[model samples]
Target: MMRATTAAAILLLATVAKAEDSLIEIVTREVKGCMDSEHLGSIGGLRSYNDPNSAEQKCFLGCMLKKFKALDADGQYSAEGLKTTIQHCPRMKSHPDIQKAALQVADECNGKVTGCSDYCSCAPLAAKCLHEGMKNKSFQTIFIALDEALDKMQS
Candidate 1:
């Protein structure tokens, strides 16, 4: 009985470790794509969450959201889909604030997104809209919060 329990525990630990690694890989790739794109990268870069704000930053954020598939083909709210995509992420899965923010991002951003090009323009209108959406207490903050939570959990 003891041996069986020990084996099960080890198996569970391994699965969790793999899931964490997978989350890191997925986020790294998505962020890299957003930062590396000719259009997005030109606007400074996506290398850090902290930097001087510019019209370009708003546009790049929109681009990253799209790349992450947080929006639909018609650029509509798809929070559920987005949630599903990161369901396995340990930090997000365990945090209620993160979950609420994840779902709200679509609500906050959808109405203003006329199209991908709208973000590209970085027009005052578009930037204002995205800023409003970001202020709603959610998705824009997820990456940093989730990263911190994960690190805390590990340590």
Candidate 2:
């Protein structure tokens, strides 16, 4: 009876892990498709907020934000959508402070970029504003969490 219960628990855990893996895979595929469509190379270019100032990089960031529903059709930022995207990652959801920081950044960026004519122009400004608005420690913490999540996924 104990052996059967142990097996069941293990199986349940595996199923949950698989579901999480699938979610990540789906998001990755969608983001990759966005990159391909935008003719963007090396997502690494977006590691720094200032680095995405180029036209192509700006378009790529716009593509990603749109794909995640963080930027609406009218070139406006959605704080709720951005927060939802961050919370979608289990590791990110574990850090409530990160979510709050993200929302604050989104709100500030939204104010800066709301009047832009298109996402390409809006996204870069938003990125720059977000970078400026976020606390250094919060920014580092978010980046570290992202890096750790990526490492775990890769491994």
Candidate 3:
């Protein structure tokens, strides 16, 4: 009975892992579509999160936030939406620290970009806040994954 239970646990884990991979793939495809639709120049040309973003880059970031439902209809940062997004995204879900940092960033940036009716302006501010807040945290891998995803889309 113990051996059977162990085998079932392992199988369950494998299934969950596969599901997470599928979720990531679906999100990546959606993001790639957004990039193509937005005519984002080149992922390589994007400035660092701390640097000032060009209009196109800002719009692209906005598109991403919208696709992920991190921003509300009015282009405001939605903490609840962000939490839901992180919970569903395997990459962010697996990293509790990242999840915490993201929420904190949302809290800090809340209402700070008020009156920005478009994501192009609001999303960049929120992203910069997150980038700065997580600079000392162990979140580099997430950014690296994003870079890799964008690179793959380029090809």
Instruction: TM-score winner between 1 and 3, please give it.
Output: 3
Score each candidate by Cα lDDT: 0.42, 0.53, 0.55
- Scanning candidate 1 in windows of ten residues, the lowest lDDT window is 4-13
TM-score of model 1 relative to the true fold?
A: 0.45
Candidate 3 lDDT score relative to the true structure? 0.55
Candidate 3, 1-155: lDDT as tens digits: 01111111111011124544643365456556767877875676453253435777777778766665557877787767765655665445555556666566656666565667788888777666655654544343223334445556667
Highest TM-score against the true fold, candidate: 3
- Summarize candidate 1's per-residue lDDT along 20-52 as a digit string, tens digits: 464445544454565566244443323224432
Model 3 worst lDDT window (10 residues): 4-13
Q: If ranked by lDDT, best first, what sequence of candidates would result? A: 3, 2, 1
Q: For candidate 2, what is the lDDT?
A: 0.53
The positional error of residue 100 in candidate 1, measured at the CA in angstroms, is 1.9
Per-residue lDDT of model 2, residues 1-155, tens digit only: 01111111111011124554644454456456766888876566354244474677778767755755567886576666665565564544455555566566666656566667787877766655655665442344222222232344455
